[model samples]
Target: MTSTPPTRRREWLAPAGLIALSLVPVLSGAARLTQLSTGATITADNARFFDSPVPIVVHIVGSSVFLVLGALQFAPSLRRRRWHRIAGRVVAPAGLLAALSALWMTIFYEMPASVTGPGLSALRIVLATVMAGAIVAAFLAIRRGDVRTHSAWMTRAYAIGLGAGTQVLTFVPYTLAFGAPGPVLHTVLMAAGWGINLLVAEIVIRRRARAMSARRGRPAPASVVSAPLS
Candidate 1:
């Protein structure tokens, strides 16, 4: 059998598909908020959430806004435009709120007695803290006129934020195959979500850096330079 080759359209299509898939978790989480607000009975897996729903609600809503709006920033057609500049202004606050909300839930929410292991909790804490730090670093880099550094940092932070979206892919199959995972297994799955996204982001960042470097190193065109002397 022959393997199919990639094309430019496919390259653009891939991000569109990924952006759609990533929205699944955000939309699902948003739907759940109505249930929470109405005091409807959530499943056993989510019972503990009722004890403290505000943080979770804030996280989901803020993250939903960040994820949806942030996806647009990755579009090459948009990144160099004025719209990107305006979007960045809004994306920062949305991302920061999401990260801070996750931190609050990790630090303060009581885990369900059924799955009280520190595995997921610890992972959330670290990711939230790093994401928040990255957001601030991006801001500082931009303020210093280091657009490249700012973009790279923002990319990394967005990757970390994508972890929650990736969790559905990582956990659902295993949970279906063998029932809900224990603490260690759950931790491993969640870590994979972050690892996979961060790895991809690093690759893109390096590629962009190389491209930018080449552009800067290119010699001026002879036509543009013209004759030095009359």
Candidate 2:
């Protein structure tokens, strides 16, 4: 058989990579739900979730759905189709559930002092709020027929939601090298994970804006370039 064209191959690569990145956390979340449902023995690490299972359950399921479906949206093939709009209807609510549940857990779940200190807790709350707000802003933008603004907001929301996957990637090598991080290190690494994802999101947003401008034979306007985070 003949090989696929390089351009076509590259187009699919991004969505494929996004799906791969999402697998670990999504699988882990499923396992957690399984454990909770099966009444697995509670440990220090899992006691908080066990005590108040609803929020964690909602978070795991919602985020899992959001990540997988959201990944498909990144595919240029899907973006050009009608299903992108249909999927957005589901994706928006799923994303809101994920972000709002996370905010609830961060604020109400009594996590162990060793696991979450003030700084990490604050970081989580802020990010969850931002994620939820981004989703809402994207929905509103779409309602107003602002496609670029909608895409930018949704991209930022997806980046934040994908932070869980990035955290796993960041923590694996770190735990191996440092033998399990302390609270301070844990917070720092968590910040780094989310920060890295957001930074990448910004770059993608800017590049897309530039590409659209190039197609129109004009410079990317400042609003399009910087509106994602702002």
lDDT of 2 by residue, 126-218 (tens): 899999999998999889997777888999999999998998888899999878888888898888889999999999998888888888899
- Assess every candidate by TM-score: 0.83, 0.94
Against the true structure, candidate 2 reaches a TM-score of 0.94
Clashing pairs in 1: none
Q: Which segments of model 1 are wrong by more than 4 Å? A: 1-11, 42-48, 113-118, 218-230
Instruction: Give the per-residue lDDT of model 1 (tens digit) for 96-211.
Output: 99999989977887666464454778778888988999889889889998877787878888888888778788889998999998877877888888988888887777777767
Residue 15 error, candidate 2, Å: 0.9
Highest TM-score: which candidate?
A: 2
